[model samples]
Target: MAKYGIIRMQKFHKDAITGIQKHNQREGENSKNKDIDSTRTMFNYDFVNEDKIKYHEEIKKMTATRVKRKIRNDAVLVAEFFVSASPEYMHAMSPDEQRKYFEAALDHISGKYGQQNILYATVHNDESTPHMHVGFVPITEDRRLAAKDYFHGKTKIRRIQDDFHNYMNKRGYDIERGEPSELQHKSVHEFKKQEREKELKQLEQQVAHKEKEIQRMDSFVELKKAPPVEIRSEKRIEELCIQPIEIEAAKTVRGSKVKVEETDFHELLSFSKELQQTLAAEHERTNALSREIDRYQKENKALKHDLKETKQELQVYVAHQDGEVEKAKKRMREKLVHDFSAEQKENVKDEVKRELDKQYEAHISSLSDDLTIEKQKHEKTKKELVQANKMNDSLTKMNIDYIENYVPKEELDKANKEVDELRKENKTLKAWKEKALNWIDKHVEKIKQVSFFQHVGGIQKRNKRQDQEIER
Candidate 1:
């Protein structure tokens, strides 16, 4: 596989600082991301900032020392950088090489955006991919906090990309730079969707393979466990019985003429040996079937686990896609506002404010009702899960040869159909929940921004009036 160096930047305002810290530092008790393997979290370490410190404190200190002017409430507080390469490439490297790769990237960023402005530079190993998170205060050379000064337009962004690629290449790493196209700038949602689709396809193939094996086993068991055949002839081995035959009194010179029964000693011994061999063969066949059943059960369990993981991944993707959609909508609204005249802008803002307030109330009420319904459904699902567990336990206690007798082929098919339906329903519910939550978050942030700007606008007007009076 081709290994490419990847770097992306995200801007965060003061309001998002706490969230950023919590995620980057892994401070939360419960991690929402199931992809993170917490056991490997110990390997995670920082480069620029050796100690784990609060981002808020670092931002505060940087602003106080490096920045002289006041930053706007909506100003980008931190320019968060996600730096990494293709997982395959990272995995192929030695421990020292991986550290060097991240360190070089960090050095390049610090060089471009001032080393003193760095808030934190952490390398996370717990997630699906090993990546580094670097936070810069965006303090300009003139000692002003302005993210736009560094990442204002496409030209600047393109140049930064080029520099990182060239710098890494010069550092003796054969990593390719991002392609200069829309394809190179894939959103998180698109990346996750592609990954999930590929994983789901693999899981589906595994499930199909298991089903085929189970069917083949079913046929094998039927043939192997059939009753053993009986032998019959004129001089028959009647169920392998050795009956005594009466050969009464008389005929031998040395006989005392006593009544007695005669038996064929050699014949009986030969028949007994043949019967033992047949029984041994049957026993071996039973043991073989048992082993096959055990193997099939293990594979079936693994398939179920894969399906469950796929479901969770799908839920994550749904949440991400909803968030992306909400962001796009917010961007569109901002663009519209930007294109408006000053007078028109005021009218549009007021109209939008009123509409948003009304919609917000309606959405909250709808969300409350939906949540209640979902809670009930959640309870029902829980009960179903408990019952299913009981059924599974019962199945575990069943004889392997008789599993098909208890769970017929038709019932198995029906159960699988039901599971598929439930999965689809769960996906739909998750998407709806994500949409509602993202909408709430977007509107809440917008309301805060509007209020802050309004206050700032008032201050500017008063200052203008004061200047006019002084001139008069």
Candidate 2:
């Protein structure tokens, strides 16, 4: 029973002002501008209410404190309203009647929103539908925006829309409650449009690429034909010289006593020899050129094959891109049609978070276990090293004790015999003792020079320091 209409408004000043002015000028000069008189129309109307200005100023002041300066100045206030009018009411109205209705609606909304200084409100009836594009400056008397304070809560926008609808209904404009289905439909429409544009762009690019490839192939074919012209020219020159020789022969007297001039004979013979040489050289050149041409043709054929293969690959790539585009469109359409409620979305988010947390915990637990195992292995290896050092120290101490205090009977007997031999050969215990002490001192010094002290008891710490000092 009602005719539906959508309304939208935004704050646009500097650049928007320039664009709007230009557009309005163009529209005013157009012949079709008169057609709009048959439909409802509304234009800029001055709002001089002081109370409205004060209300806007208050909101602006609040916004200035919380909103960034750059964004605040550049920000646009967008408002959309959906209204429905009875068919009878719409059909009964004249163009002027419809225009007045829109003007009244605009005035009512401006007053309700307390937007006294706003400008540039326009109604459009370009489609089977009607809508409005309203523009206004965001600045207030205090030269600040109050967006943050005025629309702080999520419900504020809804409240504004409701209030505007109520105001419009009160002012005799038919208004309708919005349906969720319409919003969904609108979203789907916009999504489809975007998908179509994307697909079009991909197709255009593929066409352009194919066109370039064709151009390149044409150029290659042209290059291949270029050398045949020179060969044709050489053949033409030989034919021209043969034609002159035939004419001269026809003019000569028949065989009985044809006395040829010596100079003429020499010239003819010379011409024959030169012709033979020229033909021989030309034959050789033609053979060489033929070989070269054959080689080039073979290369060209291979290149053409490669180009064909490349073109095939390009075709496949284009097909793949097209498939991807189709797949993306299908996915987009599915997403658009599949409606998920807020609760369902929230549940999905929670489930994903829980799964991620569980996986993260499992991974961290595994890492900690690995770290624990490595730590235990490190401690065991350290303990084993300490125990091995203790065993080595015990063995070294035993060796030292044996060397310092005990001697085997066989070794002692051998040593005594060697001493007696030495005495018989030289004759003095003092000399033998001196030699033995010297050998003992040398052996001790050598043992000390070696790293054996590092494994011996009581000398381990000093040996470790000496080793460390040497390393340094």
Candidate 3:
């Protein structure tokens, strides 16, 4: 089979596009080393100007500053459509067929991305394969210069290839569009590797926190009682300062003593309440963290299971790819052999045709010679035929005269009637003979059972052979 066609598009500025146009048109290439056939241009056209000379003037008209929302830099696209010569797709073509193929492909390119966008197209057949290099400005349907809008991603590239492939296939070209690269989806190993790394890091962090929390819980369990909260006795506090001051102020002033005592007790009570609330809040936070950690652990296990499944799928895909590769290789080898044989057969056919043409010329010349001789013989034969016809006419006249004078119609008719009566009598006798034969046939079996049939048919004594021969 012919290999797939390749079309490569490159963005270029006006100057570069011009350079390409010149090179492709055989103006830029060094004339000294170039062959007339090699690097030869089949036809070049400046679609913008509808001229053959220069596309610079044309490019300017197609894209200018006046065009709205235009990209100033990537104004032109130069693309090469490489046709395959292998397996004789290009090699097998007549010059006209090759031209048509390239032209049709160029038309396909233009049709794909609007004909207005194409500035220049030239078919080159002097190369190994018939191909075309076309330069087009990436203009949208609404006529805006937008290269980024079209081929910025692989989606357009794949789609263009698919469309081109279908077109070529319909035109009876033996080629396939390449399978799109699966780079978007990471390989199983790569994905698993990255995922495992992240999972491992998360697992390590969770395990560390879990270990610390377990230790804390263990420590809490080991502790039979809560930490002792220190409290100051009201009497001790009074002895330290208030008692001496109170006594010095008034020895029997009980109301002042009660007021000082009440202030110290209230402060101690508030401190104890705040401490209890802090302990309760910390306990709830720890419980919540533990639950969160357990959930993460379950998630980690599920991820591991998913990773296993992905690996299995990857293995299956790889195996399938391997089988397909082997089959493709086998097909390629077979195709190569077939092509070689077909080419050899074609060469043989050409030689045979050449020989046949020579023979046919000789045969025609001989036939012409024979025809002249035959024509001479035909004239002589015609004379003989005329003489024979005269004799036949004379004989026919004599026969007619004899019939009119000697043989009368009445005598012929009477004889015909008598013959007809004899034929009827013969038919009646045949019918009677058939009935007699049928009667004899019916009685013959019964006659065989009698002594007379035994003597006539040479019947022997009944035995195994006799029973086997006669089914009844």
Candidate 4:
């Protein structure tokens, strides 16, 4: 019976796809753990995006419905479908039939699931038995994502098995379920495993039986040699023989028959010697066979252990690789978002720059107009100060003429005091007008600098500085 074990691939493993690709494409030809000629690509997927980063992008794109902008990082990367049986099951069919069996099996799986879910389907012929390794993403037909869903309950797995078998059988492959004993209930996989174990146990029993037979033969050999040890003395043996010891049909060590009165005694001695020699050879052969079986069993166990360890390491390595790929992808995405933000900021900055420039130009123009008004006001004030000074000078002249000409002393003093007061007030007005003119010149220079910067790249430079700050 053919069996298929559906296994979930660990999330984010680099080896998940890399190793399969190597096996499927025969890339590890010279490596010690090469999968050379072990796999033939029954199907290929162009979706993996030879480029690792791009592959992830493709997955995200294809699964966009299930995987939104924010998807789980620990989503399953792959699932393995191991389909196999003993070599006899596969070799029973012709090459064309074998092809059909695998093709149909995969077709059913793909059809049952979604075709987009399957990544690769490879037929492996390099091991003890012909089998296939299929990799797929755990995506459901309705575009839902969940790796742990399909193999959750017995019903689903059974349906999968039945459907697979149904597909294969319908396509002319004589695949069927194995029979279980009346008192026993077990899965096909378990049954196959127990059957193999039973075969091994039987071989072990055979080895033990051979060892027991060897022991029995050894005991017989020892019994044949017991007569030599039982012979108490040579004198007694001669007396018992009643005459000279004669050997007949008794081969000596030199393969020559000897004549003697005690022919039976010679024969017993010769037989004991031959049996001892035979026993030595038989014991060595039996030990050798036992050692061979032991060694075979030990090597088989070691191979199994090594294979398990290698698989574990492969998974670990792939996981590490996946981390790296994810990290790389993360870097790219961050850079992309960063670049987008920067472009947006640049656009905003441009808009702000235009607005700032417009406001600056309007402000400078307003400042210029105010400066012009202030300058005109200062000129008018200066002219008024000059007129006041001139008027004060004429009053002083007129006061002097009055004081020196024909006025009373008291009246003259009063006029002089009034004229002095008018002169002081005019001087204060001149100082205040000069201060106002200096303030207006200072403000005008500031407005001109503002206008200059507005026309130059000062606004842009300031914006760039702010942008740099924002980036930091």
Model 3 scores a TM of: 0.34
For model 1, residues 176-196, the per-residue Cα lDDT tens digits are 985563334443334434545
- Among all candidates shown, the one with the greatest TM-score: 1
Provide C-alpha RMSD values for all models, in order. 38.7, 27.0, 27.0, 17.3
- By lDDT, highest first, what's the ranking? 1, 4, 3, 2
Whole-model Cα lDDT per candidate?
A: 0.68, 0.49, 0.54, 0.56
Candidate 1 vs candidate 4, TM-score winner: 1
lDDT of 2 at 297: 60
Model 1 stretches astray by more than 4 angstroms: 184-472
lDDT of 4 by residue, 1-472 (tens): 4443222122223323454456444554424332223343333222223422333444555677664434454445566565654456666766666666667767777787667777667665553345565667777655566666865655565565566656766776565643212333343234434544554465456555555555555554454445332223434443444554444565669666665446667776666556656655666666575566566556555555655565565565456445645754775575455435344777999999999889887777766665576577667767877888788888888988888899988998899789878878877777766666675577556657765445455545644653453233
As a TM-score, model 1 comes out at 0.51
Over 1-472, each residue of candidate 3 has an lDDT whose tens digit, in order, gives 4465544455554445556666667774544222225434544333234445566666667667435664444244443333333325566778777766666677788777777677667665564345566777676666676676777787765666677778877887776653354434222123323433453465456556655555555444444244544444444443444332232244355543433466665665566556556655665665675576566556555655555565565555456445645755775575455435444778999999998788766655544554454455445545654565565556556555665676678875665565556556555545544554464355444433444213322333332333343222
Show the lowest summed lDDT stretch of 10 residues, model 3.
185-194
Q: Extract clashing residue pairs from model 4.
A: 14-318, 15-318, 245-260, 245-261, 245-262, 246-260, 246-261, 246-262, 247-259, 247-260
Q: Is candidate 1 or candidate 2 better by lDDT?
A: 1
Rank the candidate models, highest TM-score first: 1, 4, 3, 2
For model 2, how does the per-residue alpha-carbon lDDT over 134-247 read when each residue is reduced to its tens digit?
434344445444444444554654555466566667777665643322232232224334434564566566656655655665565566567653333445655654643422
The prediction achieving the highest lDDT against the true structure is: 1
Q: What's model 1's overall lDDT?
A: 0.68
Candidate 4, residue 361: lDDT:
73
